[model samples]
Target: MGKPTGFMEYDRKDNKAVEPLERIKNFNEFHTPMSDKDRATQAARCMNCGVPFCQSGMMINGMASGCPLNNLVPEWNDLLFHGNLEKALQMLRQTNNFPEFTSRVCPALCEAACTCGLNGEPVSCKANENAIIEYGYANGLMKAKPPKVRTGKKVAIVGSGPSGLAAADQLNKRGHDVTVYERNDHIGGLLMYGIPNMKLEKWVIDRKQKVMEEEGIHFIVNTNVGKDVKAETLLKEYDSVILCCGASHPRDIKAPGREAQGIYFAVDFLTRSTKHVLTGKKEGWVDTKGKNVVVIGGGDTGNDCVGTAVRQGAKSVVQIEMMPKLPDQRAANNPWPEWPRVCKTDYGQEEAIAVYGKDPRIYQATVKEFIADKNGVLKKVKLVKLEPKKDPKTGRMNMTEIQGSEFELPADYVLIAAGFLGTEDYIAKAFKVKLNARTNVETKPGKYQTSVDKIFTAGDMHRGQSLVVWGINEGRHVAREVDEKLMGYTNLP
Candidate 1:
């Protein structure tokens, strides 16, 4: 440990975000980073526990409890505290391929499982991570390092999201030729489009893409594997194929007036908003100006929809959650070390409250139908309250909509952010890969290989919708497997 008593001496300090009202004025990242000295002090708070559960990457009580990348948390914290920022950055990159993406968007499972958090505030691991990576970038320590020798093994990665990028990075570092195929017009599948510019600016993705390009990884955008390029062609050309196409089939609400003009899927809405920002054109954009926006499903994506709508000058915003509100603090069953099942007010919700004079979330509620005008544009939403009850036979908790509790709210626009189902069917069908009942690609338990020979899968396509950090972990893990398969032995860490 850099300082045995550092945890006792330093209180946790995180980056300060610009006030919501001001930040909402524009779609830009608003977290003002702490200075190098202050960030080092925050890193010093790492107690360097004997067990260090912060990097355990274990699933406890159905939720991840630590850094999924198994990042060397204590080692990097010690390095950072001692002002060895370049070393700290190296230690971080040892496990995580993209700290820049995760530092900005990840929920920080490490902090939840931190030893310090058992009794007090956790070490500012996420902030420290962001600081270390940002310092590397600012100091020119993070530069393209293309492999000197080629293994002559060609690998095709079918998505350009975090998972694909990580896989490409690792495989390329191992002297394999990697090509990433993105169906969208732009790369960074979710990062480039699904996320708003406020949370993760497009330039950050572009910057990383530039570095990856310089590192000799090939990228082919606007190419759908199943359609534009034949799957058989890739299978024939590449030594191995890894599918990182994320779980993109959005789950939809089966409510009336679903075809209303102003109603959109959350992904579509966010994608359009980001495309408009990047292209500076309003081709097929859903304008939310001076309108009442009701975002269905109170998840992070729903919250993003709220934020995006507000920035688009929506008159009012409401986020509906079918489940009951979680307790403000961790519940009795959710003890320390398990992922905290408590309420969290995200930046978008904070902005909604500041602008609308009240919190935007409506818990234990769902939309009944969409009320549309004669023009078939969404005008309002009929809502109903829900109660959770154990099914008599299955013993599963199911949301039961209460009768005689229907209500209406003005909603000129309705964005369904109900999360994803699985990877689209065409990609799996093209490769003749099996899928589980959930529509996710079927791989052997604890394996990334598919039913087809020389074909692999990772990230949401393999495991279903999850965090960006988990995607990186899957990508790195799959790279090892592919390397072993190719070389008959592997050296990838």
Candidate 2:
């Protein structure tokens, strides 16, 4: 409660985004952070409610209500409001390992559950976080501090994504020699390639990697654990092994003409786009210039594809979504302190509308078939409308195709972003760990240890495909559990 009437006096303000048409020229982060004074005003708007659902991190109606990391939202906001930026940075980093990554990528569940948003707009917690972190970097407040003593216990983390990085950071802080193995040519598995440069520039990840390395965290990239390097060797060498390899398997769209050329998975497309952006190489690039693109599965990855295609000078873009459109406002069944179920026009769709004069999303529709030419090159897409229907036995709503509502659109390229199934089987097989019904690594209820001794898991590999925040959460928890099992007690927060 920096100011009693702060919420009333100051309205919520967010970072300004670059206009769509102009920003489509390059794959750079577009939003410009506000001044320090404006950020303080935004931080002042935090009422710091008695309960503060903004940090509850609870699940209601199967959706996250607040930040899964349980970030100290109110304390940091108050500190920022009072211009205590050094203290604010400390408070922000207490729970989050990488604010720079989450500030730009996270959907801001904290703001959605903010008390101020009950009747009006929510506080700009995400923007404030970005400001605090960027300030730390600019002012040289963020630096590497390696542990003074080593515990003589070496731990191996099998991924370089958020979860693996967070776990490595924590264990390294506790005097354990931590080694992270990334399969890709660079560290930051999903952060490096899976995400586009427009949202999170690669330099941010590189900067964090530099700091983590200075903190005595060894990184081994361009060497896969299950393939190039044997899992048995790591298990034999390291005292404990933590598998943070993400759910690398992408869900596929099985339709007629599925084997046609120009049809690619969303992850592969995005990875290629990012690699080309970073290296200026064309070996694996999927050029979309002058092409008509169709993206299946209207999710974040799909939106990234839309934006990427637009930047590559695509003549047209269409996003096919199987589910119906959400309402503009929250429905009556939905209430405050819960994740809102409302339609959101993301950056990519906004760009599509700005360029094409219409929203690119086709709600309640799916790909019936991929219509290709004789040479197996994708030329058009057959789309069919869908309607919600309830199953008689299961009593669950399902999207069924609508009769006689098929349509066709010119599509030279098709990107499937239908989400992921689970962790890849090779790594699981390498470790000989059991998988659950959902294909995620199985463990005891509410635990991170796997069936094999001295073996544990976290992040998308342990839980399933999820946000970076959830991955970091699982990483911190698994580190604590692993620390306890090794040292007979734990001091990690």
Candidate 3:
């Protein structure tokens, strides 16, 4: 610990963001960087506990406890405390390959599971990492460190998202030839499209990709294995193929007026908006200019839709959730360390609340019908009260609608951010891979092996749709599996 009494002396102070009114004017990042003095103090707050729960990315009571990549939180924090930024960057890069991406969009699990969080606020792990990485980049400390020797072994990684990227990075570090395939014109799959610019700028992903390229990882854009290129060809050409396409099938809301023209999926809306930002074209896309927009579903994607609509000059925005509202604090039975199922404002919610008088999310409400205009453009949404239901046979919980409590609201565009169901079918079918009941790629515990010999799966493709941190974990483990399969014994860490 840099300062024995730092946590007590220095109260938690994080990076301040740009005011809502001013931030909504552009699509650029608004969070002002924390001063070096403030960041150093925050870094000093790391207690460096005996167990270091901040670096112990293990599951406790079915929830992620701390850093998913098991980042050396306390060590890096101490390094930063002494202003040894070089050592801090090296320690940060040891585990997390892309701290920039996680530092921005990730829901800092490290903070929630921090030992300090039990009594007082936790150390500013996320903010500190952000400050450190930005510091490294600004000071020209980060550079391309390619492998020393080539292993001559080739790997074809499907899906250029976090999982695939992490796997390729690890394998490349071991001197293996890696080629990443991306369907989109850009390299960073979800990061390039699903996330917005205000949260994670494109340049962040671009910089990482450039570094990986220098490390001998080849990224092939506009080449899809299932459609553009054959998956069988990849299996034959590469020594090993890793599937990481992700659970991309967006769950749908099959309600009245489901086929309305302006009504779209949340993924589609996010992807289009991001593409527009990257391409600088807003024509033919879902333009929220002076239009009332209703985003169905209350997860991160729904909130993203709300924020994107607001930035596009949405006249009004309302986010709907079928689940009942959660308590502001942890429930009685729910103790510390569990992922707090509480109602808290995210960036999107804060932006919406700053613009609209109140929070944009409305709980215990669901859409029954989407009214459309004569031209088939979505005009408005018809909503009804929602209640919890118990199954008579299985005793499973479900949602039931309340009668005589239906209402309609104006909406020029409706975005369904109901989340994903499972991985896409093409790659799975091409490889003849088996899926579990949830439709995710089937994999046994403590194993990354698949039914097809020599082939492996990871990330959301093998597991269900989950956090990017989990994807990184799966990638690292899968790289170990592939390495073991290749040369009997592996030395990757």
- Show where candidate 1 strays beyond 4 Å: none
**TM-score computed on alpha carbons, candidate 1:** 0.99
Task: Name the better of 2 and 3 by lDDT.
Answer: 2
Question: Scored by CA lDDT, what does every candidate get?
Answer: 0.93, 0.93, 0.87
Q: List candidate 2 stretches off by more than 4 Å.
A: none
lDDT (tens digit, per residue) of candidate 3 on 1-493: 7888888888898788888888988889888877898899898888888877777887878888888899999999999999999899999988987889899988999998888888889999998998888888888877888999987889889998889999999999988899999988998777788888998899999998888898889999998888888877888898899988999999998898988888889888988888888788877577888989899988888888888998988889999999998898889777777767788787778888888888998889988898988988788899998889998999998888888999999988889999899988888898888888898888888788878866789998888888888888889989988878776779988
Evaluate residue 312 in candidate 3 and report its C-alpha lDDT on the 0 to 100 scale. Answer: 89
Pick by TM-score: 1 or 2, better one = 2
Best-performing candidate as measured by lDDT: 2
Question: 204-301 in candidate 2: lDDT tens per residue?
Answer: 99999999999999999888899999989999999899999999888998899999999999999999999999999999899999999999988899
RMSD of 2: 0.8
lDDT (tens digit, per residue) of candidate 1 on 139-253: 9988999999999999999999989999999999999999999999989989889999998988888888899999999999999999999999999999999999999999988
TM-score of each: 0.99, 0.99, 0.97
Ranking by lDDT: 2, 1, 3
Looking at model 2, which ten-residue stretch has the lowest summed lDDT? 4-13
Worst 10 residues of 3 by lDDT: 332-341
